[model samples]
Target chain A: MQTVKMVITGPFSSGKTEFIRTVSEIDVVATERKISSEVEKIKESTTVAMDFGRITVDDDLVLFLFGTPGQKRFDFMWEILSEGMLGFIVMVDSTRPETFREARTILETFKAYAPTPYIVAANKQDSPDAWEVEDVKHALRLDPEVKIMPCVARNKESVKTVLLELLYGILAEMEKN
Target chain B: MALKGNLRDFTITQLLNLVNLARKTGSLIIEGPTDVAQVTFRDGKLAFARLGQTDSSLATILHLNQKITAGQYRVIKERAGKMTDKELGLLLINAGYLSQEDILGSVQQYFIAIIRQLYTWVDGFFRFQPDLMPPEDKITVRLDLENLIIEGSRQMKEQEQLQEEIPSLDMALKFSERPGTNLRNVSLSVEEWRVVSYINPKNTIRQIAKANKMNDLAIRRVVFSLLQAGLVQLARPEGMPVAPVTSSSSSRPGAAPLPVTNKEEQKSLVNRLISRIRSL
Candidate 1:
């Protein structure tokens, strides 16, 4: 069976682990530690190292999802997880517009390592205060060709839709090559 | 020359303790990635603190603490938006919503909260200028820097320990479907039971923290202890599929997977989302 490794990355509390847990067939294994500082206002615990999960895409192919810690202090793990990955999903918390800058930086960092396809998942779409997908796209300065999708990472179907999109992007890229 | 450097080298607590020991009077300004805050000290005690626009206002703090109703908060905020710090305090008192003591107490609480937050900043530049005057008529809440530092540091250390056990607040928790027998013999704290009442695999630790008005570390510590006692287990929400339901042994279903990059469909989704924002 062929294995495809994909990454789910974003800023703090951007729902990377939730997205992976939603779509993964197996339980997600995550290394989380309590954050003491002001970030405790956002969430108590944060992913310290990485979150891992896997899914079977038919008998011959399987998909593995690796979620990188949101904080920049953990950026060193980004390269480690991104290696040999087919593509990735950049999650963003729509309610926290301030995190958009970090989301862009993550996207750029991964793209620098490999020119792989990616989808910007605007999470927290259910929140009334969340930004519109168009506005998020504009704020992130995403090129027209880059796909931006709104998702509630907590929802299994929504997470599946995002993964499918990233998979499609990868397939199309593979066709080009 | 003013004392200035990255906070990483000299923590806010260390700086405050130094100033307090020397009995220096001045303003200590911290510039962080998201906000800038200035704390004035008179004779080595905290006189006043002014934070950048990103920090929560007194009204927000009051609202979060449930000291003021949402409606009352809105009115106060609308009326006090243009008022100075001193004027706002007066307005709150004159409106009969808060007594003089309440105002003072809230101010102190707000001050402590801001300092605690500043202690968490790993990357920031700090500057100290001696002999700066307090803002005009601003409420001056003098606090012993040594005591404040000790308390803040203690809380930070406690939070770090709790974080070691509790990973992320995004984790959904539920009473263990097969709880261990130890739960029957173990006594739970009032706070633990309160947290247990909220666990249903539907509420994340973050949501539970918000519901209880506790900070992240406080909630996680409670949850961590519960997990250790085998009373609760982390689980995904119900209806979330753990894996692909259908799979074949030898077929490459991904080769013909449903397409997600149809430009026309994406454009429409964006249009719908934009309309939702406009309606708001």
Candidate 2:
């Protein structure tokens, strides 16, 4: 086992958990959800610690995806997660595109540790009210210089493209080093 | 959960209190789940406000919603998209007029930061510059009970406020408006700039909010102000990021970071911010 680590992160309800579930060959272990008096529905219980899952790409390529806690408080764990990690998978909700700024906060915090390669999955572009790609890019102010791949996370084709892009991003980072 | 404003997250009510308690002139940066805003102050009044990285079209929508002022719109337009929405939101709060509901709704592009308790920030975020003299031309504001509370509670958990917006009649006049400045002359509170410097083609405002430990609305305002100031430009210069999803910023080629002289410079930056805001 080469033991390459990958992290899946995004805003709450952005299908971060679902994305990992779809890709990982093993069952994902998540935190248990308990109901509170105020909010009746089962809100996705926050992953206070981490969400663990695994996938084997080939003979020796075992990819370990550790999903992180979405609430800002859990950010302290990122330093530990990114330590010796290969890269990350950044997910997004295009319909709620502006949420991307929160992702910037984490990246900025980790700037000193090391610049990791990551792929962006603009999840839910297939939604009816999704903001146009142009609008999303302009509003989010993504760097034009970087390669941004558009993908509908639920669709296998789109998901595959994102994986490819993420892999390329990792490769590009490796080449730069 | 707390979110980052600049680089720190404030509680939902703390932001509401910041809006109610802010007295100094200049931009109050408000960071929310999605967008950012810059609220300008003049003579300790809410003068103007505008979104960060916004153009005339989107700005008009914000203005129509009573989110910013005409003067602030002009100032922000002048700066272009350099300021991020977070910075702008913080500036607006300092100048007053922006309510937690309105700002949270806009920045997150969804309703977040629900104001529960209404007490003002008995302790507002303030860092004054003793080295730089306060401008003589402006009318001296008489510090009132609210100011006292803010000053008294500067380091406390969250300032107390009765309502999310201007809770009292006096606040309306107190936070009515002030001077203004573009990114160059007026700058972020050191805390405010910390987050603005992070936005790139890779991250979404929501993701940033989730990752931050401070208040999201507060961060949005700082980003908005930076966008207004032209200090922190966005990667998507024209429209929002066109990418379907935003990734982590691919460590772009290095750009020289801003240099800070000393604590005095920081204070001076805050004071200059106050002065220019009063001018507008």
Candidate 3:
């Protein structure tokens, strides 16, 4: 049996777990704990360790999805989760502009760890006040070639689109090699 | 739907860039914690702006600019209360009290000032009402926003860099042990001196900023300069409670560090993944 790994990461509450759950065939194994930080009152609980999900493309090819915790304290897990990954997705809350800076930092850090294929998923696009994908791209200071896809993690179609975009990016990199 | 969001998530600079790039025509209403601002644009060009409930009338602007005397300003306020800005401006121009250029220039300056003030507002709610125009009676100008956008973008970049350098305003600052040069010999700006005077291990950068009447950006800039000069370093505020460490476990801990796949194997795997995703 062959398994390919893909990691999902972003700032706090950027929908990394939801994105995984929306597509994962099995019940995602999430290590969630009550949030203790006063600043993160937006959510009741946050992923403490990581989220594990899997998709069986076929009998022989299974895909693994890992989501890293978002808090700065859990930054050590980023490198560990990123290891041996085929590609990664940097999710950003489209309605929250303040997280854009952190999103950029996470992207840079992941890129530095491994020059792997990745795409930014601007999640929460369903919100009325959500920033446009182009605006999110500009705010993130992303290069022209870096794809930023609009996503709503709860919506399976949107999640699929984001995952497909990242897969295409990986395929392109593979073709180049 | 109206375009609306908090300033925390989308800055005034980014909003302006969007307006300019999209050539949007509307009124951007920003509600700050204490005040409200309305900026009008036509074809993406700045036309007018008003802050709070203050008088942004042509006569008031002229008076504030010293184009009119105090007595004239008082009389105009008393008698021209019913006149619209356009009517007042035309009346002034006809009476030779002010030239068209003077009125337009003053209005432009006032509008720009309002926009500049908006930049300092980090926490606010802004909503763009598309196709909204300023009052018909109000005088408007067609000032290009390109320069303002450029200036704002530059300031935003500087502020971001400063914030990155000084991640937390709650963090205190302490003078470096080895300055390599005497602090007394070093030339410092008035703002820098003020910040330095408040530099104590007990006083967080936020406290220093509050004492000096400096905003987050100002304090960060000052502290960042001090840090770059080796004059001060960030330290935990005295007696502040430390956060408890939370350990995280990574999945597949004992897995290989790097993907162990030949080009052919990777290609086949990617193709299979792509086919599966596309079908989904």
Strongest candidate by lDDT: 3
Question: Model 1, stretches more than 4 Å misplaced?
Answer: B1-280
By summed lDDT, which 10 consecutive residues of candidate 3 chain B come out lowest?
B248-257
Writing each residue's lDDT as its tens digit, candidate 1 over B1-280 gives 3355666555576667666765668898899757899888888888778779753566776676677899988887797766676777777788787888876677777777788878766468876776566667567777788888797678667766877777567778987766355655779998887898898877888888778876565687788889887788887765655655664332111221223456554444333322322332
lDDT of 2 by residue, A26-102 (tens): 78887635433343232636666677777664464466778876665466676676666656776666665336667
What is the C-alpha lDDT profile of model 3 across A1-177, one tens digit per residue? 988899999999999999999999999999999999999879999998999999899999999999999887888888888888888999999888778889998898888777788999999988887877876887787888999999999998898888888988887887887
Per-residue lDDT of A1-177 in model 1, one digit per residue for the tens? 656678899888999999988767688998998886675348878898999988765565566789999876778778778876767899998876667777888888777766668899999999876766765676576888999998999997788678767766765665565
Residue B108 displacement (Å), model 1: 46
Question: What would the TM-scores of all predictions be?
Answer: 0.40, 0.40, 0.77
Interface RMSD of 2: 20.5
Query: Can you tell me the CAPRI class of model 3?
Result: acceptable
- lDDT tens digits, residues B18-115, model 3? 78766778899999866999999888889889999997888889988888999999999999989988999999999998899999999998899888
- Tell me the lDDT of candidate 3: 0.87
Show pairs that collide, candidate 3.
A97-B9
Superior candidate under lDDT, 1 versus 3:
3
Which portions of model 3 show Cα errors greater than 4 Å? A175-177, B1-10, B69-79, B92-99, B153-268
